[model samples]
Target: MFDRLFFVLGETFTALRRNLGLAFAATGTVAASLYLLGGLFLAYSGISRYADGLSGRFEMRVFLKDGITVPQIKWTAEKIRSFEGVRQVNWIPRDKAWEKYSKENPEIARGLENPFPDSFKVILSDLKKGDEVSERIAKLPATDPDGGVQYLRDEQNLIAQAKDALKVLGGMVGGLLATIAAVLIFNAIRLTVLSRRIEIRIMKLVGASYATVYTPFLLEGAIQGALGGLVAAGLLALTHRTIGEALKSFSALSQLPSLPYNDLTLALSGAGAFYGVVCSAAALYRLQLRYR
Candidate 1:
């Protein structure tokens, strides 16, 4: 079995050398497909991380009605902290608000009366549940005697919905791209097999087992796929580096997480090798059916 495997490997290599153009074409196609996929994955990862970071800073300010004492404030804080998904309840005093506002807007600080209200800054574990937190906060016993606790960012729902929609759309687009690439790959492999029918038939007539004849084609596809993945990985790395250089001054993009060199290399290399192997196997299987 070991000798047979070596023989098949040598045959596959020879075939690849003989049909170098076709092999290169297959590799190029696979590389392009994998590159697009890797880019999408990279973008998704960055966006996901960004969203998570933003969610961590998500907080709802609950203002107290007039005449509320420290006891009432403590009660309200305890209730909020006990609620589901409530990570932490920070009580921002009017003084701290004034200080922060003054520091942020020093010009307006001069004549501005302490318009800051005593507010309970409630932080939630899940940003998606912001609306739930706001609703629960408003119903707090001492939230507001006359009026309710007003949400500063009432548009959070709209933003969350938008992000969810974009995620679904991205998934759909990725699936479509993958399907198209697979069909193209399958057809390309079939054509390659058809062109080699005479040689394959001769081998079978000379008593070569189906497995023996099958190995070389499978190996060829595997090789092409691997080469393609490698090319795509290189291209993606270069593209990212160039973009990083250009956007080095942009603080936001600079802070975004990117794939480390080792991870990217390994993933792309494995993907390429796997694609080559699978494409070769599939093509060989289909071609063998016709001969049998």
Candidate 2:
């Protein structure tokens, strides 16, 4: 068993050495494809995490008409509280709202009348029900007729749409690159098989098993793919570190979550290896070898 393993390894290395240029081309293609895919994965993960955090903190603001009385505001709050999925409702008087605005933007507040309206900050237990709650609140008598209800659901929807577009675009590009890489691997293995045709026929005539004859080519493809995966992993790690460092200069983005390096590496490597094996198998399948 050990002898056969060593023999397979020897033949694999020999084939790789003979087809060094093709092997390198295939490996590089695989690396580039996997790198792009990995980048997309990381971006999708980060954005999803950020979106989830934003969703958790999402709140709806319902503005009341200018002439609304204190009693009317209290009544609106009670009605909102009775809505399903309503978690907590907080009332913000017009004066308090104006004060906050003035403190946050002193320049804008200069010589400006307190144009703020009385509002209720509505917190919901389930963010998915934001539109439903907003619809219900908008129909209230106290709600401002012109854009009384405001929530981050629209912004969240935009984010979700962006994520979907990105996924589709990335999948297309990655899939194209992966197909090119597979073709390169197939050609590399085919060339090696062609070069060793005589030897293969002799082995077949001598009762060599299919596994014994084909294992070396399969191993060669796998090695190339694995090397590519390692290269892509290294590139991703460097990119993550660079981006992390750059984000530190901006306080808002500094809290972004880091990429899962170990998981990505494993996934990339395993995927590359599996892809290579499949391509190699396909190449061998198409070949016609005869030993008489």
Candidate 3:
């Protein structure tokens, strides 16, 4: 196995050396393409996390009228259960509400009479629709006259805007990266096939099968993919660190989550290698048909 591995690698490098300029350019193109893809994915993950965190802060509290009986509360809740975009409608009984309030404001809990109200904490399917959902809940008769639906109306609107911005950025950047990857990989492999055309003909005359002829070029492509992937991973790590540091300088942005470098490195590198190998096989097979 080791002998075969070394032989394949030796032939691969020889092929690479034959077209050093093209090989290097191809590899760099692949690295740059993957780098852009990795950066976009990182931004996608960060924005998604931020949106989730913001949504977590929003829970529509439907405060009940003081005299509404427990049965009346259950009926009101049953109505809300069927409301659109309502994922979870939990009843926060008066005792539970008091417990939560007491922990947060122990002084207030000590001096105050039973000031906590019975409420339903509504978790929506999408927090971006908080305003609409809150509006619907406000009309219910059981809601407290003094306090109806409570939620962060403005923040939900902001989350919706952020989501829109992310969608636009992803579509544009992702499409460009895909185009560059396809063009560069196919062109690179075709150039490799062109460079080795003479050698392939010579091998065919010496009784070499297509398997033997194809192995060296395929191996070269796999190597190109690995090198490109690792280089791109390094570039992505550097960019992540630099940007993370810059963002950390602002206290408002300090909560931004860090990228999982190890996981991303493996994922991106594997994708790059797979692209190279597949492209190499396709280009070589086309060349074989042409030369036959």
Scored by TM-score, the top model is 3
Q: If the candidates were sorted by their TM-score against the true structure, best first, what order would they fall in?
A: 3, 1, 2
Looking at model 1, the pairs that clash are 31-228, 221-276, 222-276, 222-277, 225-276, 226-272
Using all chains and alpha carbons, the TM-scores for the candidates as numbered come to 0.78, 0.78, 0.79
Best-fitting candidate, scored by lDDT: 2
lDDT of 3 at 4: 62
Cα displacement (Å) at residue 40, model 2: 0.6
Q: Provide the overall lDDT of each model, using Cα atoms, as 2-decimal numbers.
A: 0.72, 0.86, 0.76
Assess the local accuracy of residue 212 in candidate 1 as a C-alpha lDDT between 0 and 100.
74
Candidates in descending lDDT order:
2, 3, 1
Candidate 2 TM-score, true structure as reference: 0.78
Off by over 4 Å in 2: 64-136, 140-142, 152-158, 289-292
- What would the per-residue lDDT of candidate 3 be over residues 1-292, giving only the tens digit for each residue? 7876676667678888878877776677667777877777777777667666656567778898887898999889988888877788899888888888889989878977777678998877777667777777788899986767888888778777776776677678756765666566667677766776787678777866666677887777777776778788999989888887887789776554766778877887787788778878877666664436
Sequence-dependent TM-score of model 3? 0.79
How does model 1 fare in lDDT? 0.72
Candidate 1 lDDT tens digits, 165-216 = 6567557765565455455555556665676677777887888887777777
